[model samples]
Target: MSLYQFGKNLVLVLFKPIYRMEVHGRENFPKSGSVLLCSNHIDNLDPPIVGACTPRMVHFMAKEELFTIPVLGKILLKVGAFPVKRGLSDREALRKGLKVLKDGEVLGLFPEGTRSKDGQLGKGLAGAGFFALRSDALIVPCAVVGPYKPFKKVRIYFGKPLDASEYRERKVTADEMTIVIMEQIRELLEKHR
Candidate 1:
């Protein structure tokens, strides 16, 4: 197995018993081609939880600060995470995200930009929408419910893929697409609640 897959499997094995994790709607994932797994962020563990739930290898756009640490940065790189400056435009990160999509890989993004301290859904940043528009990749809305506490049952629901083909020919604002993705995420959260 690839290093990424091996690491993912190892983590999943450890997380399964402690988290009581459950994954639903994984069948919605596309069999092939580029896909953007846009999800709601509740905690630091959200990325690994989502990654373990899905079978496909997901490349995440983590904050650039995480890449500065020595050992953690090396591990993140090995797991297919690229750096993104949290507050600024970070054109370089956007280009890298687009390249991952164009290469027909699955890219994971937390549209809310940062973890919700109160576990409440927040407005999505424009970055996720911008990537969708630029790459014309399918936006798979995912909702990760419950806290990341040990022994607690954390559920991950992957909603249907949102197509961006309609906006391919027109000039649509990122805010518009962000709203749509957030709404879908909210719906999924409510469904499981």
Candidate 2:
């Protein structure tokens, strides 16, 4: 396991006793090779909280500013978390993310792009769809129901891996495509919520 996975697991182990974590459909997650985990955004804690439910290490794209902190940046880097620029195409972040996938790892992304202020899902950024199409990776739909108080149970449900059939060889505008992909993610989330 990577050091980040070790650290993440360690934290979960400590918290498991106090906070009830219920995970369903974990079998739906791909067992190997480049996979993209797409989920709705709810709380700031959603990333690590959802991370704790999965058996494998999942990387997420965090804002670039977070990496400005010296110690935290080093920790996040080792664990698979990479920096992404908001409101712009971050080619460097995309390159690094693709590299992680090439290394046979999972990349966790919030399709909604940013946290939802009212706890409702938002439209996804096109980058996610582009990544899936370009990399030919499996997209695992995930839903995390939360805003859990301390020691409260955080419920997470994993949906079946989405086949990128519709995205294959499609020649549509980026904006048009992102909406369709985001809707796919939203539909999955609605099933459990």
Candidate 3:
């Protein structure tokens, strides 16, 4: 296994008994190809939590500031994370993500942009939609439910793959396209709730 995979596995094993995590619809994950595991972010641990449960190596677009720290940032970088500026559209970040997807790697994104301040799943940003539509990739909408606590039950609900072939052929505005994609992700989570 790769060092990053080893680290993730080590962390997951240590946290398993404490977190009492549960996962559903893991079978929905594609064995290979460009995939967007779009999810809701409710806690700081959400990314790692999702990563640990997933069988494939997934890259996440973390905040650039988070990498400013010395040791922690170094570790994050080694573990398949790249920086993305918040509050504005970073074309470079999107390009990096797109390239990763095009290489048949899994890209994890929180559709809400940042963590939900109210601890609830919020509306998704246009980026997720834009990436999915642009790449013609398969999107797996996931939900991270319940807060983290020792022995606390944390559930991950993975929705079925959302195919965007129809959108590829249409003459839709970027804004309209983004909304439609975000709405699809919202609907999946809402249906589970």
Candidate 4:
């Protein structure tokens, strides 16, 4: 098995018992093609928690700073993560994201760009919206609900996939597309939480 899968499996084994983790709508995931697993961030563990529950191997856009770290950088790359410069228009990062989708891979993104201190979804950056508007990838809205308290139930609800074709035909702006994505994420959170 791939290291990503092994790592995901290992995490599920450990987390399920401790966190009582439950995943909903995992079957909503497409079996093939490029897809963007978009979600809201509440905690530092959101990425891994969502990734571990995901059936497909998800490539994340981690901050460029993390890639500067010693061995952690290599490990992140080996696990299918790429770097993104936060708070600036990094065209290189955008190109990389577009290329990943064009290559028919799963790209995971937390559109808020960072963890929410209040567990409330924030405004998604143009970067994420740009990716959605530019790619033909399926936009799968997901929500991570509940706390990380030990033995507490932590649920990840993967909502329906928002096909970008219609949105693309309308030629919507990146910010508009991100708003739609966030709306879906909010719906999932409301329904599941």
Candidate 5:
């Protein structure tokens, strides 16, 4: 197995027992083609947790600051994560994300832009919509509800893919698409709640 897969499996083994993770709707995941795993961010553990649950290898867009750390940076690089600046529009990060989709890989990112401290759904950033439109990727809305503490029975629900074909040819603005994306994530969160 590749280093990324190996690491993911290792994490799953350790995390499943601790969190009592229960995954739902994994059948909605597309077996192949470009896909955007748009999820609601609740905790720092969300990325790895999502990665471990999905069968496909997920390339995540981590905060740029995480890439500046010494040993952690190298580990993140090896684990299929790229750096993304949090606040402003980072063209470089977007370009990398687009490249992943264009190459027919799964790209996972939080639509909320940052982790929600209160575990409430937040407005999604335009980045998810922009990438979906640009790459014509199918967006799989995922909801992760958890306190993220040991033995808490954290739940991950993967909703149906939001096909971008309808918006691909249209002149849809990023902000408009962001609203749609956010709505889908909200629906998924509600379903699981």
Candidate 6:
């Protein structure tokens, strides 16, 4: 099996049942081509939990600091993660992200840019909107509803793809897309929370 598959399966076995994960709306996932999963961030486990539940491998642009941690860094690469320097206009990371979509792969992003301390869906960074505008990939709004207590039911909701093509064609500002993306995520949270 591929490293991404192995890691995803491991998380399914280790994180899914342990957290009592309940996934909904997975039928919205695309069978092929590029997809960008914009989700809310609550805990460090959010990425793996969301990734494991999906039918496709999710390549997340993780914070650069994590990649400096020796073994963990290697493991991330094996599982198809790349590093991003947070709070900076890291063009290299953007390039890698766009490339991931161009290659017909799935890329996961947390629009808020950081984990929410109170588990609330926060405002999306404009950078996320920029990335979405740059690609022809499907933009799917997803939410990880959680208090994350052990054996507690942690719900995950995947919504249908937003009309990214409209935004792209109109040449709307990055802020515009950011607002729409966050709104979709917020709606999912309100429904599931």
Write model 5 residue lDDT over 1-193, tens digit each, in one string.
8889888889889999999999999999999999999999999899989998997999999999998999999999998899998999899999999999999999999988889989999988999889888886899989998989989899999989998878776879888887888888899888778
Per-residue error (Å), model 4, residue 147? 0.9
**Cα lDDT of model 6 by residue, 1-193, tens digit:** 9888888888888877788889999999898999989999999998888998888989999999999999999999889899999998899999999999999999999989999988877788987788789988888889998889999989999999876899998989999989989999999999889
C-alpha displacement of 60 in model 6, angstroms?
Answer: 0.4
User: How does residue 66 of candidate 6 score in lDDT?
Assistant: 97
Candidate 4 worst ten-residue window by lDDT: 125-134
lDDT of 4: 0.88
How many residue pairs clash in each candidate at the backbone level?
0, 0, 0, 0, 0, 0
lDDT accuracy of residue 111 in candidate 4: 93
C-alpha lDDT of candidate 6 relative to the true structure: 0.90
- TM-score for candidate 4, please give it: 0.96
Put down candidate 1 lDDT per residue, 1-193, tens digits, no spaces: 8888888888789988898999999999998999999999998888988998886999999999999999999999988999999889999999989999999999999999999989989999999889888886899999999888889999999999999878666778888888888999999999997
lDDT of each: 0.91, 0.79, 0.82, 0.88, 0.90, 0.90
Candidate 4 structure quality by residue, lDDT tens digits, 1-193: 9888888888888888888999999999998999998999998888778999888889999999999999989988999999988999888878888999999999999999998988888998777678888888999999998788899999999887888888888989999988999999999988887
TM-score, per-candidate, Cα-based: 0.97, 0.89, 0.92, 0.96, 0.97, 0.97
Estimate, for each residue in 9-118, the C-alpha lDDT of model 2 and write its tens digit.
88678766566777888999888978888888888777887787776789889988889999989888877798999999899988988887788888898877889998
How do the residues 1-193 of candidate 3 rate in per-residue lDDT, one tens digit apiece?
8877897888689877788888888998888888888888889988888898887888998999989999979988899899899899898999999998899899989878888887776767778878877886788878887678888888777877877778777856556666675666667667665
Alpha-carbon RMSD of each model: 1.0, 2.0, 1.7, 1.0, 1.0, 0.9
Which scores higher on lDDT, 2 or 3? 3
Instruction: Evaluate residue 122 in candidate 4 and report its C-alpha lDDT on the 0 to 100 scale.
Output: 92
Model 3 CA lDDT for position 89 = 89
